[model samples]
Target: MMYTEENKKEVILFGYGKFGRHMYHHLSQGGHHVKLATMVESNYEEASADRIKDIKRFNPKHNDSIRMLGINPAKHLLYCAMEHTSNNLFLVLSLRELYHDAMIVAISNSEENTRKLKYAGADTVIDIYEASAQHLVTNLTKPAVAEAISTIFFEKNNLKIAEILLESDTLLEGKHAAEIDFYGRGLILVAVIDREMGDELIYLSRGVDHKFDAGDTLVLAGKADDILSFKMELAGV
Candidate 1:
């Protein structure tokens, strides 16, 4: 996608730790304006100050400290990727309290913390162990598919992995997965989270044919435009 100043999102990333740094780099490379915030002075000093527009110190306990950062909740995407689960939870809670409608994405180290983070008002919670394990499993079982996913996400590509929920009115609801021509539509159907199978993700790489149903989520990798077009076509929009 061609990024212009008006189209680019402003990203506010808290904590300059490992995960924070990774997100900063990823967001920056994706053409979004990224600002790094950390509680530790050393982390602030270690960050790439030249590339980032602003680096500020924020205190999780102080609401005013966050306000001082001048984050516009509606326009900015906030990331709480601190190394400690406590800090992430507190950051999410504090941010939610300050900006009730802010979009906050937090990282959790465990399933228990994932639930806590969601309850703490995080808009999205990424489970670190679950994500890492999924990647490991994919690499072990299907190296080629793993590489494709990595290239789409990590490389300079407009392709992205998105979960498209099948609503009741979708045209594909009653069709078999193999009957739909995803590749012809410029999309790769990676897996399907079958609602009938207790939301179990059945990987399509194994050549399994699944009957599409409402409430099932299709995991697809493709360009943003193609994905949007596919959804629109499926919904007959």
Candidate 2:
């Protein structure tokens, strides 16, 4: 997907480990401005030339070094996916302290660390193991649902998963999910993650008419171009 300057989001990724690398690949492929930051020297040598060019080395222990990156607290989306839980926790803490309003997403290895990361000021904490286990269980018990997700996310290269952030006074705010013509825009409303609902994903496939609100994340699935066009239209750009 090609994002115009008006709508492109800046993504700053800390660590170049498995999860970090995966995030970089997808975000870059989607045409977002992504910067990969790492403290380990070997990670630079291991990363590809394209990624290495954008990689910035910084000392994770120092607040000054992190601030040197010049991250825009209001605009840049930060991801802390260091291989070690302690590193991720420290990074999240430092980032929260530096940019109190910034959105920090961290990956945790266990439920215990998920709580720690959240307490450390991460806005979103993704438990990798828990997510994996859930996917495994879903595949085993809900084969049809699993197959459908796999087909949309993995099997179809043209399809993309988009997280549309709703802002105050936006066009869709206060509207019901059923009232929107998503299919006309060539998109599917997969789910809605509302902040008021403790960030729980309310799947639309259940036929629930969810009322839109600011801070709600609409998860949509569709062709990349169609998704981007619809996003621009929603933003009135």
Candidate 3:
């Protein structure tokens, strides 16, 4: 019984709180239509109703109201309103058995609540403190690399591509980029190529004169489809 991650279906995100807002922004930018549910209509408006609509009204205190939202659950659901509560486990158990084939993503600050969310059938449980800690570490230790990764992974509209190093007999092992026809490969940016160019330290797209090593990772940029096809074609080459 595999659950296909279908992007075409609707997603319902509970809790119009801070973490919920952040997740909504990410998914929305990734082109997901998100519907929100809140305990009160006032809290919903306070969270900025204009940025998002398609909200379903519900309250955490009222079991019936939560059940109503769960009965015909949206294809994807994320519960993020439990941060202020001590008995968040009870709420997860309350809504667990009611949803259909929906993928439930729960966000919790406590490890105990994460366990409860998993036990109650949440597909994924995110720990708030843990995520924050990791983010802090990255921001401190690797700011530049982190920014590059964010540009590629988080910014959906950007045409940045990060790829693993590949070595094959067919590839042009020790050739300069000026020798290769990049237009035929259809890459807008061959940003970096991992290479051991003696003391010169060859990085690609530094004007394309540097030679490529046999086992060098090549960072590139293009439309998602184009980059994918380039990788496939390069695999054969």
Score each candidate by Cα lDDT. Answer: 0.86, 0.85, 0.63
Candidate 1 residue pairs that clash: none
Write model 1 residue lDDT over 17-129, tens digit each, in one string. Answer: 88898888878877898888998877878885545558988898899999999989988999999989999899999999999989999999899999999999998999988
**Over the full model, what C-alpha lDDT does candidate 1 score relative to the true structure?**
0.86
What is the descending TM-score order?
2, 1, 3
RMSD to true structure for each model, in Å = 5.3, 4.0, 10.8
How accurate locally is residue 196 in candidate 2, as Cα lDDT from 0 to 100? 95
Best by TM-score: 2
lDDT of 3: 0.63
TM-score of each: 0.68, 0.74, 0.58
TM-score of 3: 0.58
Instruction: Give residue 42's lDDT in candidate 3 (0 to 100).
Output: 66
Clashing pairs in 3: none
Error of 2 at 88 (Å): 1.3
Model 2: runs farther than 4 Å from truth? 1-8, 48-51, 154-156, 161-237
Alpha-carbon error at 50 in model 3, in Å?
Answer: 3.6
Tens digits of per-residue lDDT, candidate 3, 1-237, equal 111133234667776667667777666665666777766566578656555656677766677787676545544555555445443555566666565466677888878878867887777788989877877789899998777656765665535454536575535567766776766766654554455643333455355565666666666655566666666666783
